[model samples]
Target: SRGRGFGRGRDRFFSSDYYPYPHRPGYPWAPTLSREDEVRMLKSEADALKRSQKEIERRLGELEKEE
Candidate 1:
């Protein structure tokens, strides 16, 4: 029968367009930044986090006062 052919079930595993692995040829690696650039990025992230934390604390205090 057609379903019993040797090539019938092979396309799912060995198809040309199938990507069974994570190694992509067109994908790029992360860029390497200088020490100063890395420090700047971290500092900006820390500042943002600190601002968010302060906002969250203010909201929590308001909720506690209402309770």
Candidate 2:
């Protein structure tokens, strides 16, 4: 019967063509970077954040003055 076929498929767990790869037991791959590169990226991000904060504060001050 069709019900028997469906039950067998469910038991085997092999119905679809899509299958996932088995995970390897180990630490994930992470890239290593030099200290100079890390510091440059951090400083650039800090400068951008500082600029955005200053702009936000200026807008808030303008809104306060208008109130």
Candidate 3:
């Protein structure tokens, strides 16, 4: 243990997820999620999906070039 954080015992982060519900166990259907939170979450998910799709497309293109 020394300088700043991330010393000896601070080797890893918590196993528990900060984003609750759907992503984590026992969260269940949260009908109380605010409209703003829902919108933000949806936007983030969409962005993630778009990125994944792009990555898949790029890999497919590379594979096609190989063949």
Candidate 4:
């Protein structure tokens, strides 16, 4: 029981060379966020979706005109 201890083992497990898969989560630990940050993030995503939707509609209309 007197080896280098748990932290050393855990560190070796997470070291860069040990990554075996492409889909590893970007962060090593769970993130922390408050209600305000969560709301802001959701609003931004909604705005992006709406803008992309309108752009897609415009592109579809243009394609229809070409035919």
Q: For model 2, where is the 10-residue window of minimal lDDT?
A: 10-19
Quality of model 3 by C-alpha lDDT: 0.73
What C-alpha lDDT does candidate 4 achieve relative to the native structure? 0.78
Question: Total backbone clashes of model 4?
Answer: 0
lDDT by residue for model 2 (1-67), tens: 3433365553244443334456435688989879999999999999999999999999999999999
What is every candidate's alpha-carbon RMSD to the true fold? 9.2, 10.1, 9.6, 12.1
TM-score list, all predictions: 0.59, 0.55, 0.55, 0.58
Question: For residues 1-67, could you state the per-residue lDDT of candidate 4 as single tens digits?
Answer: 4433356654434463456678656857868889999999999999999999999999999999999
Q: lDDT of all the models against the reference? A: 0.78, 0.75, 0.73, 0.78
Model 3: pairs clashing at backbone N, Cα or C within 3 Å: none
Ten-residue stretch with the least lDDT total in model 4: 9-18
Best by TM-score: 1
Model 1: weakest 10-residue lDDT segment is 1-10
Write the residue-wise lDDT of candidate 1 on 1-67 in tens digits. 3432356554534444546568546757989999999999999999999999999999999999999
Writing each residue's lDDT as its tens digit, candidate 3 over 33-60 gives 7999999999999999999999999999
